[model samples]
Target: MGQGQQEQVATSLAGAVSEEISASLAPVDAELERRYPGDPGTRQPVHTVYVPGDAFAADTIRSWGDQALAALDEHAPNAASFAAVLGLSDELAEPVHSRVRAKLEHEPIEDLRVDFEDGYGPRPDAEEDETAARAARLIAEAFKNGTAAPYMGIRMKCMESAVRDRGIRTLDIFLTGLMEAGPLPDGLVLTLPKVTYPEQVGAMVRLLEAFEKARGLEPGRIGFEIQIETSQSILATDGTATVARMIQAAEGRATGLHYGTFDYSACLGVSAAYQASDHPAADHAKAIMQVAAAGTGVRVSDGSTNVLPVGPTAKVHDAWRLHYGLTRRALARAYYQGWDMHPRHIPTRYAAVFAFYREGFAQAAARLARYANRTGGDVMDEPATAKALSGYLLRGLDCGALDIAEVARLSGLTRADLESFATPRRGDLTASGK
Candidate 1:
């Protein structure tokens, strides 16, 4: 072939390839555009603490915190080590004792999901109602007593018809009993577990709306989290990813999608020994969740480590160590939240999270400040980089890893500058003198 003819053919082939790519990805782009509300990324708790419905009480968390602190003291060498483990400065050594006390006494429960499913399990129908009502009463007492966490909710049974009636009944009874004490607490959510179809989420939204109206609350006053448990929820029979579709079915009310460790792993046929948050199937599900729910602002949480760090007969430092290792793995995967099945896990949870934020804070703060000041640094600061740094700082602030004064001292930027960068915007992020 002639050289000119060959060049023309190559150009035509490139154009065709581009068209094919765009055509194949049109649905993905469209799905992204219309994703439902996920975690706002404004502030998310590091873990969702679940207690059985029949057993939950406001002071239960304080007891857990107390136990956690006691466990740490019983295990950790000294005050310095404790402070160091939590990424606290020397000054904090004195106050962190009281701080830890206050945290336990006040808001130790970050995300509380009173479980009616596996945690509560299938019980006598009356027993289920009684447990649900008891949970409602305790949570309501917490609300009036000002002991509730920032995020509190209930996890109902799967809406798979077999238990759908029972799930809805439990929710209804809980809400009714809760309102009798006072108005609903802030950041309340309903967790619908074992989702298999998009329509189930839509139905839950409608149910919440009706509950609001019946209670004389505003529309959209309630929100929900979908537990990603079954294979069907992740991959539709239609041969497309369906998690986004499930969130969409929420109609702007899905706050997060939580991975159910055992059920999800079981669905994938992972043996009991291999089923874990770090498993490949679990990671794939989370990756799909991240893509479908990223820009949509939905929070993605990894599944729990079934292994608790505590031993019935011993200190079980090795158990705690293994738990910490797994926690670090989850953090490395950018999943800041997981499940703390036991009080001892709480200490390990904060330890891992503190290490993550502290190790990166110096570099992140410098890069972020330099980016904000339009000054060149060792690293080029792009918009996404700025946002990530801002998020890192915000998360640190939320989780108590970094305080305002500490942030100011480290980042060399004002709180206002931090907030400004935190909200994402589209633009060229050219470093000055780059």
Candidate 2:
């Protein structure tokens, strides 16, 4: 062929490729529109917190089971909702259930999460696969028994096989068994730990799509929560664009983002000597995640405080309790949904959540009410004033410190007006509420 003919062929191929790329992206764009019709970035307030019971350590698991149940019993009156973590081990399954039943004798249990790793990282050996399968079976059986806990989920291993090898396979087998045995659990949360990039999450989303298809389930049925434990994930050089990509890749399958405090601190060489939870550095990381997840409908949660003393003391315990409360409040103010690693942490969890929301709601209501009364349509004449008032109301709503109705009422504005100004602001409110 002549040079001109060859060049023409190359141009034609390039155009074809471009057309194919556009065709492929069209559905993703349409689906995104369908999933997020109003504002693709507006974050819905996350009111509930899911506490992982650290199912890997037997002693910790048992203790958490007891503490969780006790907390539920003592605080159920004030508790909005609760979730328990169960390790997927045949050996531990019975004990976990027995404890769960015992603890829930007084109060109702709503959710159970089976942690695939028993805590010593993932077991890559073939023998361990058998053991894992057995554990998965046991958990399925327990869920089939129709206990009070309606929500069943699993925290599958992360991408790192050394840390949790049974990542995809375990989920493949467990979900198959659960579906085959009976109805699908109320919800399935695939917790991805040690996530460094959005592509890691996107990969899971693709696998989940395949799994859902193979299992004859609807696409996007399974929900995912990314553990933002690495410094890279939280503080990307591109301003959390990577995190945004990962959330977007989840394609609406992503539900929440969790902070992995100890792991993250370890990654950053932050000393373990000091509690990772509530460390200023950890707070900074959480803030970054909160910003990344803004307007994404994904809830963010802080990592757990690991400083709980084994034994109880009146004053010492109270001090520890206060510390936990402060940590939870900090996370709550950031608009994250869940925390991890301990059940005894529930008291402070509830305290911080209630205090944060209650105070936030009250303040927001007052401010919005004032804004509504003071700024009528007359304010709309001044673009600068309108923007300023809209900005104030939107920030309060975004932080979960205020509600949409209040924002609407205060600004004499519609919900659309408030939502239009929903952009995350830095230093508007400190995590510590100072």
Per-residue lDDT over 51-81 for candidate 2, one digit per residue giving the tens place of the 0 to 100 score: 3323322232345546765654543322222
What C-alpha RMSD separates each model from the true structure?
Answer: 7.2, 14.4
Candidate 2: deviation at residue 219, Å?
Answer: 1.9
Per-model lDDT: 0.79, 0.55
Report the C-alpha displacement of residue 353, candidate 2, in angstroms: 2.5
lDDT score for candidate 1 against the true structure = 0.79
CA error at residue 108 for candidate 2, angstroms: 7.3
Q: lDDT at 231 for candidate 1?
A: 93
- CA lDDT, candidate 2, residue 315: 39
What is the C-alpha local distance difference test score of candidate 2?
Answer: 0.55
Number of the top-ranking candidate, with TM-score as the measure:
1
Per-residue lDDT of 38-102 in model 1, one digit per residue for the tens?
Answer: 23556788899888887887578788888887877777646576655444567545444444445
lDDT of 2 at 280: 84
- Pairs that collide in candidate 2 are 41-295, 42-295, 43-295, 198-246, 300-336, 300-337, 368-410, 371-410, 372-410
Clashes of 2: 9
The C-alpha stretches of model 2 lying farther than 4 A from their native spots are 1-112, 118-120, 124-151, 161-165, 235-240, 315-319, 357-434
